[model samples]
Target chain A: QQQVKQSPQSLIVQKGGISIINCAYENTAFDYFPWYQQFPGKGPALLIAIRPDVSEKKEGRFTISFNKSAKQFSLHIMDSQPGDSATYFCAAVDTGFQKLVFGTGTRLLVSP
Target chain B: DTAVSQTPKYLVTQMGNDKSIKCEQNLGHDTMYWYKQDSKKFLKIMFSYNNKELIINETVPNRFSPKSPDKAHLNLHINSLELGDSAVYFCASSLRGESEAFFGQGTRLTVV
Candidate 1:
């Protein structure tokens, strides 16, 4: 069974528009949620991360809004640009154990 | 310098053959992980090592084995390659168990 589920298998946004991707987890034990961005022929890179204790975390133009009670989290990109086109993955991990469960990826396309 | 490095960016091998993928991390992290991304772009954790000791092993087949000679190096060896094994493998390292991870450029393996 998939521990984490992500929505919108693909997304397209215009430059200066907002881009959003959502994810939900079934396991309540998950405490750490992280987002990864991957380009073609490259490895995934850490974008942003949030802990369950925080309702939201923002860095630069990337923000992660987390709802601990709803077991859901979403990534928001402000002023999306063409360079933001890539695959995004949401992952959950239990601090008690080191295993990380990843959600199905979301491919984002930003057109100028 | 690359924080995490994996050798043999692309490998094409026939069925019943054996191959190895080497991974090394220079981030001074104690935890390392091996992740596989399938054709559908789903990423799954296969193995994890902490301080050169095996910590997590997913339900991967016995044909796949991971060896960690040291905290900085983790290698994967496959025996009897199969078409189903064709995918991109990534190596990652983290300072803490459930923290942000640094990933290496993936190694694409195509089993014929």
Candidate 2:
């Protein structure tokens, strides 16, 4: 199974709150997991990423929590701001295959 | 400078028409990919090229073909486009064996 399931197709959070999006993958061979943020009329950009070796990775206000055993990962945006309103996608890739599988995007709206 | 750039950001055509989307990456990456995002925001991989060689091809229709003349450029050609072919196509590039991939602004194709 190459699918990566993501929850909450849409999420609304208040500014200064926490925004969380979850994703789970079926392929155990996936060693790299990355989260991408896409704004209106823009391409998906790399927000943050995590590997199986680490349980979590934090970059600025964005953090990725990963669980190798559960084959799941999530993106946490602390102090959610209106500027963060956009579509977020979680992706997985097996370095050997180099095929990046993406989850159905989650549209996040941070209310001001 | 843009890392990954695709041409013709908006393409509108009728069914049975053939079209092409051009992509180029300036990151000197050895791998490039084409992804399709449907109306529901579900992203799927159609093709991937590494070192100007066809590597990963998903279960896409034969009407879709990808050509890479050089490592920095990857182009997608479609034949007999159908109504279902309407989607936003994205071009991405990454270094071999790396988890980070840069994406283009995407080409939105509308087939009527």
Per-candidate Cα lDDT values, in order, are 0.94, 0.94
In model 1 chain B, the worst 10-residue window by lDDT is B93-102
Question: For candidate 1, what is the DockQ-based docking class?
Answer: medium
Name the TM-score of candidate 2: 0.98
Candidate 2 C-alpha lDDT tens digits along B26-106: 999999999999999888999999998999998999999999999999999999999999999999999988879899999
- What is the docking quality class of candidate 2? high
The TM-scores, one per candidate, come to 0.97, 0.98
What range of 10 consecutive residues in model 1 chain A has the weakest lDDT sum? A93-102
Question: For residues A2-27, could you state the per-residue lDDT of candidate 1 as single tens digits?
Answer: 48999889999999999999999988
Highest DockQ model number: 2
lDDT string, candidate 1, B74-97, tens digits: 999999999999999999998865
Off by over 4 Å in 2: none
* Model-by-model DockQ, in order: 0.77, 0.90
Error of 2 at B105 (Å): 0.7
List the candidate 1 regions with Cα displacement exceeding 4 Å. Answer: none
